[model samples]
Target: MAGQLSTNSTDHAHALARQVRKLRETRGWSREHLAIEAGISLSTLARLESQSVAQPGFFTVGAVAEALNVSLDDLFRSTRTNPGLWSAGYEGRDIDSFVASLLDHGIDMVADVRLTPISRKPGFSKSRLGEALSQAGIQYTHLRALGNPKDNRAPFWDGRVNVGQARFRDILRSAEAQSDLNRLTEQAVQSRVAVLCFEKDEERCHRKVVLDTVRERIVVEVQSLS
Candidate 1:
């Protein structure tokens, strides 16, 4: 019975870590801010969020829950069963908030599917975006082969999204794209990755099709963040 109880406590700690991190991010609070609000040291909060604490004290957990303005039961119940795949767009958000949203969703890697990753948006250009993600401890990979060709982009901006999507499907059939797709598939199996693009709407974005191809190779839970 003691061993079983220990296992349960460990599970609870993992759940609590996820819950606290999510709650903190939802409020746009940083670890330091949450630590100060909870009257705990930053290291303690970091350990909790990192699941390094296998059995955090009851009062400490309660303090964190209170700081996040959530009941302990509500926090525990928010634990997700799967990390899943996430999709995001930088349509109207600045770089900081965009990175924040990715972190909020627990994404450790981002797959950029733009053919020419030169964004007019300030920080979204390939190098800048990659640097920002790295600073946030997230890996960024650009899969140029997954990008829709320029000839195929007009239909997405115009009314014939299906036409654009069909053209992109053809692009995916090529050897280079297939190679990248395989790489992305392998990465998805190992990490929480997000497919990123510029369009706010998933249906219009080629990322939708990119995700479709990924789904063909693996069973993944997909969620789009605005």
Candidate 2:
């Protein structure tokens, strides 16, 4: 009967919606928490997930991607294939899809390496970012020692360095810094690890320094979680 066919179609659609919702929740994200990250209204996520609306707009998918810190490719990745979380880029600040990618890779920790750790961007800032990650099933920790100094290693700047570039090697060569990087890599080998910073541009940020140090010790695949 036509009624039976329609019911089957609705069931299938709801099943997919449930999959998407469960994936995001696995990271522990609330609809509101995800909404803020994606730069969308809470009502939008509520409607999408609750209604199981088929073919949600591209902008929504993109926003969800940004919130989750993953890519569109990552969002739809079948769990039957990839069993872990991975790094991904954003399109429309899609936190949902981004979280979906994290779910894909099984990312559990975020090691932040920002020189300033401040941000004009919403989710990139320290506290907000940490909370968002926590809501998304990722642990957050800031490693200030691994970050670049405002003086760029000037001795007199923070008075921690004896001279210019003196502190460079300290930050570059410290046990704490090394420990952080090593810990990150260990996570990558065992789980997924994301390096956090304010700037979207990886090269401009001190995350590179931590990444370089990470590379020296372990075979971590560097990724821009922008």
Find the candidate with the highest TM-score and give its number: 1
What C-alpha lDDT values do all the predictions have? 0.79, 0.55
Model 1, 1-226: lDDT tens digits are 0001112334455556766876787799999999999999999888887767778888899899899888888776665434457888889989999988886676766888888888889899988998887656566788888988888888999989999998889989999999988877876665567888899998888999999889998998789874
Candidate with the greatest lDDT versus the true structure: 1
* Candidate 1 positional error at 152, Å: 0.4
- Candidate 2 lDDT score relative to the true structure: 0.55
RMSD of each: 7.9, 14.1
Error of 1 at 104 (Å): 0.6
What is candidate 2's TM-score against the reference? 0.50
Error of 2 at 104 (Å): 6.0
TM-score of each: 0.66, 0.50
Location of the lowest summed lDDT over 10 successive residues in candidate 2: 1-10
Q: Which parts of model 2 are misplaced by more than 4 Å?
A: 1-21, 24-106, 153-170
